[model samples]
Target: MADLGAGTGLFTRLLLSAGAARVDAIEPNPEMRAELEAALAAQVAAGAVRVHAGTSEATGRPDASADLVTAAQAAHWFAPEPTVRELRRVLRPGGRVLLVWNDWRGVDAPLNRAYGEVVAGFTEADVPPLATRVPEAELPGLLPGGFEKRLFDHAVPFTRERLRALAGSVSYLPSPGDPAYAAMTAALDRAFGEPAGGEAPLVYRTHAYLGRLDG
Candidate 1:
């Protein structure tokens, strides 16, 4: 198995927990790869998980090295054709791929709408999801054999603090000490006043695309 854009090894950790014999965790950023290596030091030392410095389009693994390739919340940034070629190179015959993203498009929930407005102010454009902007991905593309999409209705509860963390986790969102960070957070505070439970639901759905990489 190869996990692209492994980041801090969030999904990589899940793969280990699910009994995958081995996983080649590929992440381009040195900082993130370091964090993953540190967090999974035992697995790395045991040779169960290997962290590599690479990207979706240029994984350092050998041809047919992976039985499965997965990208979670990270494929939007990938350049389609190169990434497709790389996936074909690294996957064994009939090996599978999974691409997942959280969908918030067209959502009109009060909290979601309010949050989108806040984000839009910082981005200086429409608040439509970046996932939706990717070509043939949110629906279908690279998978010439076609793919299966499974949607899971989900929601995350967020208070101001949790919301700040969530925003920070996203690569594009303003982070602490950024010029826009304080303003974005202040706007969020206004959009979501203190709730009874200190959190409110941000409704969204998870989209999982599963396909065999025969093509």
Candidate 2:
């Protein structure tokens, strides 16, 4: 199994826990790959994980060798056509491609709104439209092949620490030494201080689209 864009190995850990005998994690960003490697050290030592420093466009895996190809939140950074084409190339006959994302519910509740505001502050208005944008409504056209779409609503335990970690995982957030980073941290602190239920879990609506390679 291949975990494309396996930054920090979140889903890579999941894949290991879910009966995958081997996991090949492909990551492009050097810093992210470093983090992933650090996180997967135990698994790597046990020979359960392999880290490939690459991206989905060029996974460097042999043709038709993978049983399953999965892209978690990283699919939003890829070129749809070439990515799907390459995914097809690496998948063996009857192999499957799975695209999954954990969409945070940010607009519904008070605490969620506050959290969303903190995130919105980091958005760069001038940044160009990204090459890979996963719009739920546009999934069908992106693949050009038969696919199955499924939605799974799940809650992940949320703490101020976890929230801060999530924020750190995003690319748009101000860098550690940047002036804006202090302000963002201040905002998050203020937002978390308000009276709220303790250890309340945040709901993440996961969208997964799976397709069989047309071999």
Candidate 3:
């Protein structure tokens, strides 16, 4: 399996936990690759997870080398056409491509709604909304076969500090020293006020799109 844009090996670790024979974590960012290597050092040393500094369009892997190619929470950053071509190149005949994202379900609750507003306020205009960016209907045109969608509902309980950290993790959001950073932090504090249990819920609809290439 090839896990593209495997930041910090989050999905790579999941694959390992699920008993995958091997996983190639391909991350283009130097910092992210370094973190992934450090986080999964044991797996790397055991020859279970291999780290590659590569992008979705140029994986630097042999033809038909992977049985499955996966991109989790990272496909939005890729050029769909080139990524699909690259996936086809690296995947064996009839191999599958899986695109997954933890889609925030804002309408589910007040906490979720507030979180969405906080994110939107901080998010740059160049960043596209995940909800509308990848239209499920158009996925089939990008690959040999059409794609199938699966959704799983889940929630993460976040304390105030964790929520702030989560907000800070948004790539387009202003950093600590930036002028807008203070404002964003202020808004987050207001939106994610102290809950009775000291935590708030962030719900997600895990979206999975699976497609297979023609042999």
Candidate 4:
């Protein structure tokens, strides 16, 4: 199986745990790949997971080599047409491609709403929203064949500090040295205060889209 844009190997670890014989985790970011390697060192040494420096549009794997391809929370950065072609090239006959994302479902809740407001204040108008970029309705056209969509609901517990870190992790958000970083941090701190139980709920709808490629 080929895991494209396997940032930090989150889904790769799940695949390994789920009994995948071998997983090629392809990541272009050096820092993220380093972290993935460090976290999955034993798995790498065991020949269960192999790390590659590559991108979704050019995975560098031989044609028809992978039985399955997957991208988690990273497909939004890819160019749909070229990426679909690359996925098709790497996948064997009748192989499948799965695109998964953990969409936040607590937008209407108090803490989540406040957090959204804080992010919005810092987010640039030109940056496109992820959902619109990789819409479920359009996945079928983007793949070699049509696709199916599924959603699973889950919740994560996070403390105030974790919440702040989550907001800061957004790619488009200003970094520490940026002028807007201080204001963004202050706003996030105000919006997300310490919870009563020391942990707040972060509800998510895991969206999974699966499609197959023709031979």
Tens-place lDDT digits, model 1, residues 54-109 = 99889999999999998887887787778888999999888988887776655768
Rank ordering of all candidates by TM-score, starting from the highest = 4, 3, 1, 2
lDDT of 3 by residue, 1-215 (tens): 99998999999999889889999999999999999999889899999999998999999999999998988987767777788888888998878988888867534776789888887877888875654336566566544576778889887888877777777776678877789888887888888888534887788788898887553
- Which ten-residue region of model 2 has the weakest summed lDDT? 127-136
lDDT string for model 4 (36-128, tens) is 999999999999999999998899999999998988988777888788888878988888998888877434566767777888888878876
Question: Which candidate model has the greater TM-score, 2 or 3?
Answer: 3
Q: How does residue 190 of candidate 3 score in lDDT?
A: 85
**158, model 4: CA deviation in Å?**
1.7
TM-score of every candidate: 0.85, 0.79, 0.88, 0.89
Q: In candidate 1, which residue ranges exceed 4 Å CA deviation?
A: 126-140, 168-180, 195-197
Off by over 4 Å in 2: 31-47, 126-133, 195-198, 213-215
Candidate 1: worst-modelled 10 consecutive residues by lDDT: 131-140
* Candidate-wise lDDT, in order: 0.81, 0.78, 0.82, 0.82
Model 3: weakest 10-residue lDDT segment is 129-138
Cα error, residue 94 of model 1, in Å, equals: 0.6
